[model samples]
Target: MFSCSTMMHIPTSQFLKLSKFKPIPDPRCKTKVATLSMGCFWGPDSLFGSIKGIMRTKVGYTGGSEPDLPTYKSIGDYIESIELYYDPSKITYLDLLQVFWNNHDSTDKSSYRQYISAIHFHDKEQEQQARDSMKKMEETKSNSIQTLLMPYKTFYDAENYHQKYILRKYKIFLESLCLNDDEIKNTYAACVLNGYLGGHISETEKVRILDIGLSDEQLRYLEACL
Candidate 1:
């Protein structure tokens, strides 16, 4: 004969699992900031905005002398540009360093779309940390490390309308509130190519240039599939 024991059920807050996403003091989030330049600011802004503990995110030009200027045309674009704010408590600045590696193609051009990776940190330790991570990424990742580590310049907050672009453009975020994390990441990956951008990608292939970048490979793959 087996005896059954009563198990006490503890009411746990959903916050336990998503603890990394806990709301931090963004207003006083004095963590050192960093800037990046990948491509059209809309996608980068949208992707990073969803990340928790990001005090703020801004889009603009960098790696040039005109810190006060706003230049969008890639025709003669000289500045590599983007801006991001993070809370060090939840995510370290180094975590962002790795993020920069995965998100863009550094082989395009020095100042071209997702060509160079640059880090703008405030102090010696932070710079060292970013530099170390950059080196490590170079050794580990298939692509060349084009991320330039430098002092941060002025940050030009994108136009007021551009803020929260994913929320504004996709018309899905409002309802995403009803979903969970895995659901949300999947939704994003699925809906990423919706409409014109959809139906292009073929099945995964064995021949992918891990070093170059995904967008170009993606376009080629889709074309072959079609």
Candidate 2:
């Protein structure tokens, strides 16, 4: 039996209907990728995923020196990081950089490499932008920003359990969507739902997503969960 602490009943048909719902991509939109490390990756995953322009968000390990694979328990020199895809037409890279700097305590130094705040820039332009942003931040605070600006090497996807960490708490909601682990990690719907469940989604984004073909039952369940 499907049960939750919220004790909301969802019909089987709702699940079936939601299973068919897919996000329609804009043909004209060119997506840009951003990789950021800010403490634990889970919170950043939810935070960035909630934004309207973000197409997908994935938590992973990057900028590590170790050759071995990095798991949560076995991370070598890797840092807990989040990589997200966003439509540049809707949101600029500078906007995401601002969000990254604003949300995390970049000033705090961490002894552990895995928890250090850093930006893994994909290109020269991004590297310059990150450096300029860091300079601005340092100027505003009148202190050196401890956040590292580095060239992005590779992103190793974290274990299945790490994806959509917050939204996974609600079993009924996940069941209704009928998505497997990979789908949950990649789908825009799951990303948005994860954001909403984590209380990161703004009202404007809420209204925008609500009008995106969600059934009445799904809408009610999402609202109730929030």
Candidate 3:
């Protein structure tokens, strides 16, 4: 399933009222962009969602010689990847490349088993670019970048149940966490989370309901989202 960045809900009217706070606007990303696989898509989606320049992101399967559709039950059968649609005005491919390096452990190749931790690159340019970016990161950040940058192949869309996982979980999670804000519907992002939270039982549902880890307000937030 796809991971999601935090999308807090705020009503449109109230959101406008609070616009004085200058919340980070959605990404200006406008091109068809792709990134290879990692262990999971949810966390990656969540991480990317945190960035301001991203417009939209999708989670799917990539790296196999042919298109490989990964089922939730068969998640292990495929490599987890993401396809991002972004506005070039907000973030550059170079910028997203940096994120790719930062988000996952891309330090070795042979050790990166293709069946499992194999990090594939979509093209020769992207492969080389990843290497170049790693070098730059090493020289400037005092560290080396390492990841298996393989070839571009095919990508298959995951099942519908797997899409927007975090959003769905966010709703149920908030209800369980009690992290609710009554003004949810007014804001786009938060509403997304709220819709998800309210719509389905999160993959983490059993544990959350079982754990007394939330504060009063957090519990309220969860309730509010639900």
- Residue lDDT tens for model 1, 119-196: 667778878988787777767767675656778666555454444433333333223234343332223222222211
Model 1's TM-score against the true structure? 0.55
Quote the positional error of residue 32 for candidate 2 in Å.
1.1
Best by TM-score: 2
Tens-place lDDT digits, model 3, residues 1-226: 2223333442221111111112234323346465655556655655554454454556677665433355655544456676665556777767887777665655433232322333456667767777777677667553344444667656666664445445544433333423233222122243234223433335454233223233444444545544
Candidate 1's C-alpha runs over 4 A off are 1-31, 74-80, 110-115, 170-226
Candidate 2: count the clashes. Answer: 0
Q: After superposition, how far is residue 4 of candidate 2 from its true place, in Å?
A: 23
TM-score for all models, in order of appearance: 0.55, 0.87, 0.54
Candidate with top lDDT is 2
TM-score, candidate number 2: 0.87
When summed lDDT is taken over every stretch of 10 residues in candidate 2, the lowest stretch is 1-10
What is the alpha-carbon lDDT for the whole of candidate 2? 0.80
Model 2, span 153-220: residue lDDT tens: 88999998889887787666677667799988987778887788778887766875674556677777
> For all the candidates, what are their Cα RMSDs to the real structure?
17.8, 5.9, 11.6
**Which scores better on lDDT, 1 or 2?**
2
